[model samples]
Target: MRRNWIIAEFTYDDLIAVYIVDVSQVRGNLKQIDNSRLDVTYEYYPNDVDVFIFQYSVDLFMSDGFPILERPILNKLYERKSLYSRSGYGRVANQVYFMVEFPYRKCGLLSYLNPREEQLFQRWGAKEIHLTAAWDGKVIWRRFGYQPPEDEFAILGLRYQHWATIHGIEYQEPQNINDFPEEFLKDDCVKLITMYKVLEECI
Candidate 1:
């Protein structure tokens, strides 16, 4: 039987030790899905104290019974690379916070994974989460409640104007994700900005 193993451990307190074990269990559960195997790395930075990073990647294959071309997009072979970090301070002192970087996964897989990850974050006392949304993620992450910081709204408005001018579309300042023009959704060439959520809003 395959099992999840720790690549490294640098625990300074009970909280971090428990967090590490929780991550291992999550990895094990991930492996059970479609008999997929995952490579996970967990690291703790002592110099920064209270900073931890976790990364994992997996490639899932479809069953032979499924027709290659007919397979749903979600079931098609795709690699997922995700990175997460926890910090002690951000917008508050001694806060448990998370920064999600370069997380790319199919919607179906994310449906299975996000709740589990959120549970871990909540248990670890996460107060905020930040991430940069890219590609289709700009839409997906917004649906998950991440929004641009207050200061970023102006910058996004400027970007919207630029895109509208290039695409010959009407320009309207977008104050939030919902206000963005439809063209922004279809244009992958447009760059997205960082988004964040205060945990209290969701929890």
Candidate 2:
């Protein structure tokens, strides 16, 4: 099928937004800005325009009792040139791989996020930003544009900015994103986490 993604870019005041779809509640006619549908596979649209304008993320699964990776921890360090956000759509769709981005400083009243991070997200044309304060290992898909499975969860597209513009209006300060996971804090996993932002988006 010849598919085309309806994309729009604008400043925060321009009212740009991300389309966050409830994957568990997709029905049909996703052509509308607020409308959404179930997750689709690559083979479903062989002749479609592979247009990924910004970053995106989704939760996923490997197998029964198989451990899912905390990829975002590493993925986040590459903030600007990368994509970040999570959706429970992966496991529901029976797949692996997700996306991740650095966490913005917590909001206080009405002006959260570091000016530098915000500028970076904006410069990358992300327009939208979404993330939960806490991590839910039982859930929470990684954040990035990974190959999608056949299912979807909550989808936040270009419309995410709208949510931020309205609700995330609060003061924010720099937050120290722990490079290492708690499992490694005591040197159990013994993995090292030394990260820095990458200038290149695609590898």
Candidate 3:
């Protein structure tokens, strides 16, 4: 009922590591840091209120190619904010999905501290971390021993009809961005790409 988070920042050697933990769990010991070497900061984020930390592209759904969208119109919907997984736990109980990892770059290896982060998430009682990544995200995740089960998909597609109505954009089931009126592309264009990963350990 009370969703809580603990964000911690530490300087380990040259890497300035920052991570989040869910405070809901009562089991497991929090990682012990060497006080002399530790320089850290902490913050809290609560549940009940959904937090939006980043924006994602809906560009892939704009036009279909490999792993084409099932329904371009239904699949173009987008949510401006990311939320905690009801499954619970991970970075802020997977509370806020940040658009931190992408095709251009990926989450870096935390060296020896990687285990500590995992232990922290386990301590926080996270069942899994859910996220949507571009198709290429699979390559990035695979290096970490995690892979998105779904190859291509979409989220927040229901808003398409309403968006079209307000923008005066024509409705088409098999939506194509090219067919869109010039004004629609200029005013309310949307896109998407490979939607990957949902409810999986993010270690």
lDDT of 1 by residue, 1-203 (tens): 11343322222232222222222333322322332222232322322343343332223322332211122221110011121223334321121222222222332444444454444444444555566665666777677776776666667777778888987987766767778855585576557566766565234
Q: Provide the clashing-pair count of each candidate structure.
A: 0, 23, 8
Error of 3 at 179 (Å): 32
Off by over 4 Å in 3: 1-39, 47-92, 95-108, 131-138, 149-203
RMSD of 3: 16.7
User: Every model's Cα RMSD, please?
Assistant: 10.5, 20.3, 16.7
lDDT of each: 0.44, 0.25, 0.30
Which prediction has the highest lDDT against the true structure? 1
Worst 10 residues of 2 by lDDT: 104-113
TM-score, one value per model: 0.54, 0.18, 0.30
Q: What does the lDDT come to for candidate 3?
A: 0.30
For this target, which candidate reaches the highest TM-score against the unseen true structure? 1
Worst 10 residues of 3 by lDDT: 71-80
Candidate 1 displacement at residue 20 in angstroms: 16
lDDT string for model 3 (78-135, tens) is 1122423233233322322223213212223122333444454444334443444333
